[model samples]
Target: MMGLENGITDIPYEVHSSEDLGRYLIAARDLMPGDLVLTERPLVFAPKALPDPEACMPCVGCYKPVLTDVGERCAKCGWPVCSGNCPGLRDVRHHAAECEVLSLRPDCVLDNMAEYYRHDALLSLRCLLLQKTDPENWKKLLEMQSHMECRTPGTESYDEADEFVVQYLMNNFINKFDGKLKKDVPESSKAILHRICGIVDTNALEIRLQQGTELLGLYSNTCVMEHSCIPNTKHSFVHSPKDKNDVFKITVKIVVPVVKGSHITTMYSHALWGTQARRQHLKDSKYFACKCQRCSDPTELGTYLSAMKCLGDGNNPCDGIHFPEDPLDDESDWACNKCKVKVSSSQVNMLISQMGEQVDNVQMMGGSVPTLENLLCRLSTFLHPNHYHIYSIKHSLVQLYGRQPNYMSQEYLDKKIKMCNDLINITKTLDPGNARLSLYRSVLQHELHSALVLTSKKANSDGSFKSDEDVKALLVEAKTAIEDALNCLKDDMEETAGKKLYAVIEKTKKEFEKYCKEKQLNI
Candidate 1:
């Protein structure tokens, strides 16, 4: 096959299309891990249509949070803006046009404004504005698959969103812009509006803004990449500095090496989700059944992420794992790997549902280690050690151990260390290079370092040199692990959690070096 290149020469991937998969991206040349495969600027991005009330409110123009409710509102439109001097508000193509329309609407006047009018139409309206202001970008957006036929008019997803677009947006805003403009408002056809909404729903990526508020971004190029449960490339959104224009850029990097001609993929579903859950999400949201390698494998690449415990005997539980006989079939039987005991898929589903409810209840109680521990013990009766549900409880414990009151005892710390290590191993096999794995690895290293320091202090108080060599060796190990975590997190420091963790790890490194010097050990 011949390679086709876009205007950007540095991008290693090119878009390709087929009847079955539609448009997908393929690597034009060999790409190593951490190599930049593509960089994309969003054609039209906006805050989520209906964000949680508790979420920070973002500026209408730039999508950055105003930090306080009292921040500046546009003089003409009365919508949130960072400041009167905000550059985004001055852009003729975007905010200036939006302000002009809102200024003409008497219902949008500050005192007469309704709550529904403020939010329900912003995203779709922004998209409409893009069509008028940037025709080239609108053309690019129209090339994307909207899957409009699948989004039938009566469907729940289509009904509410379509009503909001037609009633609140087109009627209240676009059609009403009649006599107020020097130029007449562009006619937005219902068919075109429906197609735009479908495109946004199908391909928009969830991105975090500068103040950590989430927004939906529609990238012209990156939207064409296919979804995979085991994706080779990872993508992150970087916000432009305040000095620069408020443009957001997505950087796609290969997490695993890709040979020339291999298709570059990105994940749409959560990495930690099981095959069944991932497939269901893809089917519902993207309108396709994913037959990815990870989804087809019963053992989930040997991590047994969806395994259940075998019920062999009342006295001694079977050490076997239970998995779906045919993972692709929702009604497939679940069979034990060792005992060959088969159970109907319905029975297995019911058990999992009950367990999930119980887990949700425990999570709602929040930070109760004893409650979580008791629940984990009870769940062990029916769930295999490597099951996703069991891993969820263990994952909670890792966060609770040292932070909770009275849970920092040496015994608990040791248990925490072991659980963190186990989770790290599971993640390495199933979700390696994931941001969560880097976090767990960092937590484990920190806990180990703390434990070693305490042990060395106790031993020194008792005048013992036996543990000196052991402590030194452990300190080196902890130091090395933190270094690995630092490397993993170097590119992610823009996030709040990453920033705090980066500071903590940097301080810990200095402390480790100081301790080594005091002990006269060359580590």
Candidate 2:
């Protein structure tokens, strides 16, 4: 066991290592829900590679997107910055050290849009620069996991890092520094650069700013927690905007009661992905196969996220659902629980791939009610009602209803209500602790409240709208739903969508209560 550094003492957690789990954080004291377990700023942070060529380029200093045709550039380095006087460009820990390095490559033309995409190397360069500027923190970073062996010469990971990061840095800047080295880069320096790249890839967490600029941040203590599909803790970030000197930091809070010796966990994969998808992602990116409880269960704890309807041959149509016999094995055959009919893993993969493509298409087409409904209708025959694709489509549908004037009909409202209820149930079952799915569940709750409020106004078959008693009952439910939604978003930072939604829902809740008071409809 090693003590945590970076002034991370007196927290309810201890850093422990095991043969199987490597270095991980464990609860040193009993933790209750909402317990503030950890808070730490990034060891290093940098802008992500511009994934969208058509999108505005981000300022290298402050990471804000350059919205105007020609944005401000740093006075010293000539790199894009939100302003010529950006503080981030002056901060020693951020762009200050690298600004010197980038200045060395003055001849390199950065006018091309493709040149902006080279920002992938920016983070690794920052990490490498730490070796000189912040040597102690740099040592701490090297102690983190790199999994270098898994990313050897022939691997795609190796090739990407080698070409984009290591070679770029050496050829453009490092080799030219002081004109001290030969044309050929030294193996030791190259190895360190590669190791830095791996560390960033493995440890960095993806973050999106309020303005929708995406970046990566590597934390010292927070990155040490182990990964779980159903994490016991939820983390929120405090992003620093240009006007605020509030450096970016993260807060990790316990979402469920955990015993003193339990592992402090955080999710590394999307909560909505199926077992295979999650496991494969972990294996590919983190270089480890996840054997978490959720991954081991083929039925995904009965939510059936990956299950498909087992349509038997023409003569004998079976009504069983197909699930992986051994979910941990990538090539495990899928079998029907009822009819015992078997399907190859390849066949199942193909089906999932094809359905996923269709789902993507529908989402790209704006996910309108009619499109999602038609897709859901066609897919309900071949997929379980709770399939992740179906779940995703329904999630889109949940928000679409009541937002548009044409979607306020009884049928759409009914569908929205049903979808909200079903999604809420599935999300809760998968994330019983409500840590990983807080924002998602909050959105569902808000949508459900909206649907209920709208449904209360529809005329009954008897030609009368909802009675005072009925409307009051519905309003009470709506109030509870909004309250829960607000509770889930209470930790969200300002200027975020969650915070805006919270304000809107708070007003809606007041209106609901006001209507009840005016009508004299006491509960």
Candidate 3:
């Protein structure tokens, strides 16, 4: 293999294909954790279109927010933009060709905002423009999987894309001007638009700007990794300061050591979602039923994220947990581990649905420690201790116990510490390298440190400490936890919650050190 690597020496991964797993990335050689697998600029990027059209209003030119009702219109295209001097307005790689195409329409500029702007069609237009502006990238885009057969005419995805994107671009931009383009408009066709929409839906990754504006970005090499419930690769965004054309670049790194010929993986669904939820989301969005190791296990690697408590009949009040007999088979019956009582999938679904609505309502009410605690206590009756729904409520309570007022009792502190430890352990087992659970782990560490500190302070106030050595030990552990939290959040960007918590933890560490020094307790 070493002798065969004659031409490509720098690349760390190679693309491989099979009948079951389409095109996917595989390790080119033995790679260690944190090894840079790939770094690639986006093929194309545009502001994300939301369900609510007014949710995000970024300028098509510079990708900056257009603050006013009627933003500064482009002289050529009559579209909302940040300013006349925005660099992206005239760049051939971005908005220039789209501007030329939009300039051809008779009703290019309209008085009504909704009539004037179609946010959903913006990205499709940008992708279509690539055919003419950047032919090399256009070929690369075509090579990506679109799953157009699965997204046929009558499908919800197909109809939505056709109505919102394809027809909008056609009726407004191309066909509105005598069904002819003046040599500059990128080649547009219904089939091509359908493919582009499918490609964007399947491959685009969400990128958030420093100003909190979210955009969708499609990358060439980064999208090749296959999906897994437990992924071995993690990717982060790097803001490119030197290159203005590519505002954001993504860097993919291995979270665990990989042997040569092994598949490089990334999680496509939320890490906290249970097996059923994760599989369903993957099937609906990416068009696949994932049978990964984590998905196939009924125990979910011992997290029991999908387990429920059995409510046995009055004749035998049994204390047993119910888990799916076959996690891969959605219709399979769930059986109790101890009592051997069986329940149908529909019964479990109905229970989960009812619990889900309650959970949603409580979360929306927002974090009052007492309220969340009460909710968690009630959920414990039906859910396993490590159920995903209970984990959700406990996550809120963990942060709230120490941060909120009137909840600093010794009991609350102990509860906070226990929840932090449990969640950290579960996440560690599920995501060994903290790749997917970095933010959660960071917060858990910070909360654990806070609880330990408060506990020590309470002990001192009550004169219950054995000696200053005990206080010193607690402070030392607290310092170590805060440092670990900081390490977990080191790669977070400036505007993120992790960075903000990083700053808070930094101050807390300094204060702890200072207090220890003043008390003549060296740490």
Best model number under lDDT? 2
> What does each candidate score in C-alpha RMSD?
3.5, 2.8, 2.9
Candidate 2 vs 3: which has more TM-score: 2
Give Cα distance to truth, residue 321, candidate 2, Å.
0.9
- How displaced is residue 508 in candidate 3, in Å? 2.3
lDDT of 1 by residue, 283-377 (tens): 87898888888889998888888888889755666778789998988889989888857888889888888998899889887838888999899
Candidate 2: stretches off by over 4 Å: 1-9, 53-55, 67-69, 108-111, 179-188, 241-246
Candidate 1 residue 233 C-alpha distance from true site, Å? 1.1
Q: What tens digits encode model 2's per-residue C-alpha lDDT throughout 186-222?
A: 3228889899889998999877777777788898778
Best of the two (1, 2) by TM-score: 2
Which parts of model 1 have CA positions greater than 4 angstroms off? Answer: 1-7, 49-51, 54-56, 64-72, 81-85, 92-94, 108-120, 179-187, 241-246, 313-317, 403-405, 435-466
Local distance difference test, per candidate? 0.72, 0.82, 0.80
Error of 1 at 356 (Å): 3.3
lDDT of 1 at 392: 85
Residue 166 in model 1: lDDT: 56
